[model samples]
Target: MSEQRTHSPQEPQRRPRITHNRKKTRRSKAAAALLYVLFVVGLSAVLATVGWIWANDLLALNKDYTSVIVKVENDESFGEVVNDLKKNGLIEYKFLFHLYGWFSNADDKIAPGTYELNTDMDYRALVTNMSASSSTRQTIDITIPEGYTIDQTFALLEEQGVTTVEKLQDMSANWNYKFTWLKDLPLGDYHRLEGYLFPDTYTFYLGEDAKYVINKMLVNFESKMGDYMDQFTEESQYSLHDIITIASLIEKETDGEDYGTIASVIYNRLENTGAETQGYLQIDATLVYLNGGKVPTEEDKAIDSPYNTYLYKGLPAGPISNPGMKAITAALKPENTNYYYYVLNPETNKHEFTRTYAQHQALVEKYGTANEEG
Candidate 1:
């Protein structure tokens, strides 16, 4: 300003204007850069928030442990399964679960059954639990006692909700079980598998197919009798069916205390068919079986039935009851003795073996009781 000596007016005004324009340009550029940074930061925060929510759902993070029972139909679609999960409060995001299922190919791996799922399970675990061999599938522990008849067993199965008795009966009669011993026994009779179903505690799936349930018992029976199968088939004069029949008789006769002695008496009676015993067996349990689980009266022995060992000679048509391993073994290997008669002693609650009719009559008179079984 002090040096304003003869300067041109157009030149001074041009310099000031150029400086002002440069300052304005620098301020505008700084503001633009700040606005761009704020925009980038805001977009990044929004994207991060969305990513966190998605990852949390996919991973099942921060979820309370809650159990839910899910039943998947055989023909249920993946969409239906996702809907069930949502309805059961197992999943938060149905679409996200569908996306995960699509990526993991879970549609092809799901199986038809009832499953027990929890909320803490991740997407991968959920898919795995829906598989055929899932451990989380619902199951029932059924203990079929020894001596359960086919009807009784089926009733128990139905009672436990494992299957219907009608279905079990139908399958038992029609299913052609692949086993050598089963060949001689024809179909069309549900009692064909009466003595073969093993009696043990079994874990069955809820609403299990009747065929599968029957197969499990049959397979268990085969495995349990595997060691004795060869012996019963080859060396023994009796067929495998015959052994089971005799064992069933023994099982129904006594309370497992006199199994071996009863077996000896039975063998003796069979051997001396022409002797005083006349091979009648005279087992009261047989009459009881034919009399509809009633205590056999004196007239009940005269009933005409193949299962009536008192009337029919030799073994019955089939097993009278499902015998345990002890009774079965006793039948396979009977004790060698000359006993042809036996009577239950009321005082001792055990059968007294006799070689002659006179001794048996004496015990019967002394005990003042008819025979329990022999």
Candidate 2:
């Protein structure tokens, strides 16, 4: 039935060899699995170390307490911010901060200014401290007096280290400020915003932007003149610009209690264009403006300038100076009077108004004509 096979001792040995090879394969596989586990553990440790460092930087943790001043220039890129932070010891990792900035929109939030940063501030706090409304930024309190010309205002701002005069003048002339009332004003002249800069004390950044500096004053003017603006319309005889121009004249003419009376004289002169004044304002203050803030001489009257009320008719092209609320109110609500001419009396330091040229001449002779001498 079945053929009997002879068994060699070597056959048993070959079977044992096969078992040994299988054992060896199993041992090799176990070794590979242990190596893979060791590799994963090492990689995880490295990642955890890196993550901890980044987290420490982001949260401003465990670092020595230090304070530094960081200055971000106008239009500066975020790279520059990172460099400043790095240089000032405010941050240790520039690349990580940049990534955070990109994700958090820190570039848009951080404004150009001088900031006082300390080790206590986190990355988010640092970004906030550099913003336009930052409490840590340096500020200066300045008082811009009433009747200040735009030049005077700019000079004052420069003196207080708020901004450069050249920058202010440039922005005032060319910048297209977004305000409904400013639409009619044409650009190109620095004096275009003369009457609109409301005179008041303000708190401004030490090195503020020119646009923002000017905008603050303009916004103040709008806020103060809100009620008057509501009363004006397209059908009104005098626009807000005209009223401001008139107010400027009144502001320079007298500082006493004659605001309403002076305003009445101005209206009387303007309304009676056919009268002897011939629509010419004939104001000595305008001549002073033409003569570079000097007391106008008799020759200044003859020099041809649109601001010279003696030479040209109507409101001296624009406002001569910034007016306060009192002057503005007088301009809006002038006293009802029939007087057309006025002369400042030196003895009383008040203006004398009269309807006739002869009366004004008499008063001028008595008062020796104010601010007319060379």
* Clashes per model (N, Cα, C within 3 A): 0, 0
| Residue 224's lDDT in candidate 1 | 82
Candidate 1 C-alpha error for residue 370, in Å: 5.8
Ten consecutive residues with minimal summed lDDT in candidate 1?
Answer: 8-17
Per-residue CA lDDT of model 2 for 204-313, tens digit only, reads 88778989999999999999988778878899999999999999998888646988988988888888899888887888888878889997887998988888888888
Best by lDDT: 2
- Residues 1-374 of candidate 1 have per-residue lDDT tens digits of 57766955675444345878889999999999999999999989988988888777778887888999997765579999999998988888999998888888999988766799998888898889988799987889999987777778899988987777888888889999888889989999888998888888999876677888899998998888878887755666898998888888888775558788778888888778897889878888778778778888989978988988878898888987778887888888888888888877776777778888888888878877654346
**Candidate 2: segments with Cα more than 4 A from true spot:** 1-69, 83-105, 122-124, 369-374
Q: Candidate 2 local accuracy as lDDT?
A: 0.87
